[model samples]
Target: MQVIINGEVHDLEGQILLSELLERLDLKPGRIAIERNLEIVPKANWASTTISDGDRIEIVHFVGGG
Candidate 1:
């Protein structure tokens, strides 16, 4: 499957949930925000949200810096 994430296109395999995608990418659950298909997906719903082909995902991670 192909999806757009943060303005880039990514090709992924099989049906995958948001949480699983994050885990596969090694992203910390508490450190990021996600928007799917122009809608904000709550952190709690990430586990239940399924990512499909052509879906647009925006992942914003918090960073501490000056």
Candidate 2:
């Protein structure tokens, strides 16, 4: 399956949970926010949210510097 992540195309083997996707990408869930298919998916829902082919996902990482 192919999904658009942060404006780039990524090929995934099959539909997976948002949480799994994050882990596969080596992303820290606590420090990131996700927007899937133009809708903001709450962190609480990450484990249940399913990512499918042609889905659009936007991941924003939080950085503390101050």
Worst 10 residues of 1 by lDDT: 24-33
**Which stretch of 10 consecutive residues in model 2 shows the poorest summed lDDT?**
25-34
Score every model by TM-score: 0.88, 0.88
Model 1 earns a TM-score of 0.88
In candidate 1, stretches whose alpha carbon ends up further than 4 angstroms from where it belongs are 63-66
Error of 2 at 48 (Å): 0.4
Against the true structure, candidate 1 has what lDDT? 0.92
Clashing pairs in 2: none
